[model samples]
Target: MKDSENAVDIKLIFQFFMCCLVAIVFLSSTYLEFSDYAQFQHKLKNKNWVQKTMEITPQMEIEIFHYRNHQSKIIFKENQQEIFSKSCNGQLELICKYIENHEIQIISLNFYTFLDKNTNNYNEFLLNTIAFKDKQGQLQTFPYMTDAPNSPQYIAEIKTEFRSFFIFAFLKHLIFAIMFLGFNLSFNVFKKSTIKLINNLIITTFSLSFISFVIRYFLL
Candidate 1:
């Protein structure tokens, strides 16, 4: 009877350690996702044009031409490879009008792409906006200058709710966690006769989190 009680205690201790490991992985993955999303948001708010541009297209170079008539043009190139060009009069005519009226001072031009990390896809990153110095000399961003129908509508609006961002990130990671467990369970990958259900779950969670970490570290 004493041996039986000792065995139970040992099992409980092992289970506790396993649970801790799983929790660490889950929290780490969520934090990584949240951090990346936060960094992206920070760039948007601060108008970190050069850093943001390098993230989307590391090889590309950006050039801006300010005309005497208060019009502007932005060009993207890659070592003689002309990638994209945008004139203020085209999609950015409203911005030109603002400049002409001296409502704002053009500080720099920037491009943005809405990246969906979960799906590993992104929308077109384009030079369709300008960062400006307002009357108070504060840097402000004017997003979605492009009139193209395919451009993301959300780009035109300002985002301030980071809580929603975190919630989305959490749900995304949860989905990945569930999928990982389902795949492993379907294959009976943890079918060891001695392993209990809780242990199996803990192991699966750790595996999923590790895989997620590796992918995010290398890709994002």
Candidate 2:
């Protein structure tokens, strides 16, 4: 009876350990995806504000560069020397300003793609509307989009751009964690097995973990 109880305890302990391992692995990966998605959303929300600020600035030229990884660099040039550069999803906030006739011309601007971590996809930076505040502190917006903002084409484009990110971030992780826990518990059950049961559990756990990781990598 004592031996049987000890065996059961060992099995439960091992199961708990494997469960913890899976949680840690998935948690870390999910965190990265969450971080990227958050930054992506933040940039999108601020896109309009940035464009307006840029439009309000005086005597400035802007150039955008796209990278293979789907990131973009926006450079602001004044006199071709006081160059201000910022990247999409970067830690630094977009702050554009210039002193003209002793008045601070605080402005913002830029367009850039956002990468979706799960699907390895991204959105194209489209030139939308430009906005700026007038001398009376009233905001004015000008059309800059190729298509009308209310047009079906423009609405469709925005909708499809970030469709997969939220689903993958919330749904996929939950499914994977549930599946991992189920498999880990099943693999740890060793009723009537020989002394090699522990070794079998170890090998099976490691193999499953590795396979899961590979699948996730390819999915990304």
lDDT of 2 by residue, 1-220 (tens): 9798788778777876876787677667865764574454445454332221234356776555567997666576886754455553432213122122222223444443445557766444544533445556665553445654334575555546545654555454555555554554554344535325554665565456445644553343
The sequence of per-residue lDDT tens digits that candidate 1 reaches over residues 1-220 is: 9798777667666765675577567677777766675465455544322213432245666556688997787555777676666786655677656666777766555655555556866544656556778889898877754443232343233233344644555565565556444443443334555335644675676567556544653342
Residue 120 displacement (Å), model 1:
27
Off by over 4 Å in 2: 1-72, 77-144, 148-152, 166-171, 174-184, 187-220
TM-score of 1: 0.31
Number of the top candidate by lDDT? 1
Judged by lDDT against the true structure, how good is candidate 2?
0.51
TM-score to native of every candidate shown: 0.31, 0.31
